[model samples]
Target: MAPEPVRETDPTIGRLVTDASRDISSLVRKEIELAKSELKVSAKAGGLGIGLFAAAGFIAVLAIIMLSVAIAYFIHWAGLGLHWSFLIVFGFYLLVAGLLVFLGVRSVKKVKAPEKAIEQGRQIPQALKGKS
Candidate 1:
């Protein structure tokens, strides 16, 4: 097969500019596509993690319900009437719940804002501008 002769026409500035602009536009579109694909994957993983966490919490709640019933039955066997046994179990759960709420509130109150980190971040601009 004979090789085709090369006809090289020097590209004009306008042509070069148009080609560069087109290439940049194509590059930007490709980058946006890549970002969308990456975000889809991350969102899927995040949704799965949330689902698993909810399942774990649901199982824990079921376990707690079963334990409460079992404890109530045991109390009944220990000579307490069935009604009183369940009542005692219910009261115990209420007491525990109240204690948990109190502790949770205390722990939340003890939490302080990140003042040191905020101060450091504020200093960054000053440092960069040689004003620190």
Candidate 2:
């Protein structure tokens, strides 16, 4: 890019400094906005995933409950004691709940925040400070 010719009437360095300041301000603002937008998109996606997973877990629990009741009744029909049949169903549900909890924790731990924009933002201040 060619520098504009400095006129004899007005000072050029002052104009250059002002333009640089404005441009840097605009750049930092835009960078901050970009970081914010990226974070928002990431949060929405993660939230949706977590919400869907929770819904799936809820449905699973409901299904397990229904199936347990059906099985307990079927076992009762085969001459097993009623309370013992229900206890067996309860034990099965506990096992399923434990598995769900373990899987949920692992899934959440794997979900990480957006990193690139955050890194760029972190560098902006450092760059402005003349640090590498």
**In model 1, which runs have C-alpha deviations exceeding 4 angstroms?**
1-8, 104-132
lDDT tens per residue, model 1, 18-127: 99999999999999999999999999999999999999999999999999899999999999999999999999989999999999999999999999999999999999
Judge candidate 2 at residue 42 and give its lDDT: 100
TM-score of each: 0.68, 0.55
lDDT of 2 by residue, 52-90 (tens): 999999999999779889999998889999999999888
Q: Considering summed lDDT, which 10 consecutive residues are worst modelled in model 2? A: 4-13
Q: Which TM-score value belongs to model 2? A: 0.55
The local distance difference test score of each candidate is 0.96, 0.93
List of clashing residue pairs for candidate 2: none
Residue pairs that clash (backbone atoms under 3 angstroms), model 1: none
